[model samples]
Target: MRRIAGVFLAVASVLGAQPRKPIQDVRIDILSTMLTGNAGLGEWGFAAVVEADGRRILFDTGARPETVLRNAEELRIDLSGITDVILSHNHGDHTGGLLTLRRELGRRKQSAISKAYVGAGAFWQRSETSVLAAAKNAYESGGGTFTEVASAREIFPGAWLTGPVKRVHAEKNYGGTGKVRNAEGLWVEDNLPEDMSLVLETTKGLVVVAGCGHAGIVNILEQARREISKAPVHAAIGGWHLFAATDEHLDWTASKLKEFGVENFLGAHCTGIEAVYRIRQRAGLTRRTCATGAVGGGFTLKDGLRPGTLAK
Candidate 1:
């Protein structure tokens, strides 16, 4: 019986020594962005379809009503199968196609988007000019639901939402001249408090996806570190909103990326081409690792990053 016990212990030791299986491939398909090469339309907006752990989530809408819809149809990507949608913030460029997406995609499949996940203060404004305010009413009345996440939480086993990232870095990215009233009837600068990002956990590392990075990419990463894991970031894909970043700011941003160990970077939308190049130089990222994000490009675990038009 001693030999039997020893054999069992050996097996247990080996089993314990084995590494945990990595999560399945999380495929990200960019449906809207500034650049497009696959005969698809390009616009000044952000929208992507993320397939992770057998769930499909539309990250954001687009600037115009037809941009995302036309691109999706052009790319031969079906949005009808997706039931979950995440609105990164309340900006028009990010939420302009909310109604169109739901209406068009829902026509094909009634359950195209059953629920929308948004930040807590996304619809804080009641003005008629507020796109989000209009969407909230129209959306809810159409039998759809919205869940406002205020803090970091795992929406699924391997997918997490870094809700309302804490601005822990010197990156106060937003500089728009807008204001909104809070629940207490106090008006404040619309610094996009509803800004957030999606963090996906995999065996390699965490993959952070952002809409506009208006909350500051560093802030998003810090929140992910606190809520998700402190592991090296495997990839960061989406709009960086650094169109007008100064040299000093870009250098600081690059340093932060290096500090977080970001391996792959896809800078899209307001993440100016020159900014991507500068950051690449400072962060020691190669063309293959750090490339501009386009309408027909994205990243996935199985095939790695599908670089954009300006990959070179």
Candidate 2:
């Protein structure tokens, strides 16, 4: 009987049969960001470790491979167990630490980064030399794997990746700059079609985690609600690439965020300090609900938020 019970528990873990806790119980630890953490260092990059639905996922590699490693050590976090990773886009700042994280962490745990997830076109040729090429090649050569996400799908029970967000709005988050191969295999103005975000579903609402948000925050939110879940947005975290927005754009974005039921925000990376403040004021959010993300900062269902700076 004991042997049978042990076997059942093992099977449950392997098959993800353990009854899920509330989505709010999931905690996200910001591993790298522009803002300072208690002990971790900052950089002009973004990376996080999301602990949700009993899975530990490395969201994005930071601008420098060693920066993440150094920060993680200072924060007393361990990456040896990260079996899955996600590349928000193909930019260097985001994909810098892929090889390092996989190699260093995998040394301790054989499956440190066995599988990676990315939006479609992450590997498409760019007019300029793509930074993601070398790292991805090295990773694949070492038997690492990748999954190109094209549409919205729940990668885990409660975690969904908004694959290739639809640009129904005029935001033009990327300003249609750069050059990337489009469907016809022609290089065109790169709107970063592969830019995507992570959506966490909770009983209260959804938590959207954007990486650069080249797809436009409004578009990501609307699409998440349209295709992923009807639940209201509880929080907007991570990078949104709003550092260059004009006052008019910020105003519209703030109003739209309020309309989308975004009650909390922890803007980091390309989300400039001024932008966060303007958005907070325009959206009528209190300091408790809006703050600036940092290296060691994070958010959870219970504690709400731990940010480096708060909206005044």
Candidate 3:
């Protein structure tokens, strides 16, 4: 009888150790612009904040923590209240602000928020091998915890960091250059990895917060559907990496997205102005342009969609 009781207790403990399902209320802050003052294109990055069952989770610190912090302050966002921080990839624009952010939180006397660095290990390789390596090292040295993502994991109830997206589509190469330094000094290239996105299950549908969509937007959407099993996509916001895409690629992507019935899209960063115009021309989809000063601009599952106010 005692053995039976012990066995039952052990089973209960095992079950208790399993992670609970995430609750869901997701919001993303477009902390900065990929295009700077001169309009030179840059890497895509944003800050994703999710409030699920009262817990606050931050995703992807932008290129400048100061910029993100300033926006947070203006929006009345309390960094001290954040519970978790998730970095989508290792690019400087995506993770440049983590150390500063940690310092800021420390200054406020708040315990360091738990952080999850989700991406392929490749992100930490050298720039000659991987363009995002430097930023990955910087983020790690800044007191952020790293979690290797193999499959979807719940960071909060109903909020998941979809693991590294698998490349399954034959999209155009859209060759472009990325800044890198080596024995020969700074250079550029067409090699970059397609990574994960933040997926939030809302009352209306799934809201996908992407980083760069290097994985192909269609692939990301299909994976999101696979993860949630037919959860209609309420909205998708983030860099779409469509700056150099051909007309056919853009058209095909738009067509595929329409078939999935995504309600809203807020494309920024690498999603070129041309792509934005084209997307807007498509019917039944609400589109918005996001940039640096628009940090506080975001959408809620309940609030529907809101664009950043145009700067004068």
Clashing pairs in 3: 22-156, 22-157, 22-158, 23-157, 23-158, 33-292
Candidate 3 TM-score over all chains jointly: 0.77
How do the residues 1-312 of candidate 2 rate in per-residue lDDT, one tens digit apiece? 999999999999999887754475668888888888558788889998888766888888899878888888888889888888888998888889888888888888888876889999888888767678767778988779989999997887789999998899978777535798888989888888899999988866898898788899999999999998888899899999899999999999999999998999989899899998899899999787888898888888777877854322
lDDT digits (tens) for residues 1-312 of candidate 1? 999998998998887755544567788988888987665788988999998877889999988988988888888888899888899988888889888888888898887776889987888873326677777888887768999999887787778898887777768788667887776888877778888899988877999999999998888887898778888899999998888899999999999999999998989887888998999999999888888888878998776788665563
Candidate 2 clash pair list: none
lDDT of 3: 0.64
A best-first ranking of the candidates according to their lDDT comes to 2, 1, 3
Q: How many clashes show up per model?
A: 0, 0, 6
Structural similarity to truth (TM-score) of each candidate: 0.90, 0.91, 0.77
Tens-digit lDDT track of model 3 for 1-312: 999998998998888855544445555555565533222223345665656557777777777657667666666677776746777666666666677777787567455554655665434334343324544556456665667776777765677777877678966333445543322443434334426888887767778887667777888889889875477777878777887888777788878877887777777666777786676565245444222223456576666555555521
Instruction: Give lDDT per model, in order.
Output: 0.85, 0.86, 0.64
Runs with alpha carbons beyond 4 Å of true place in candidate 2: 1-22, 175-177, 309-312
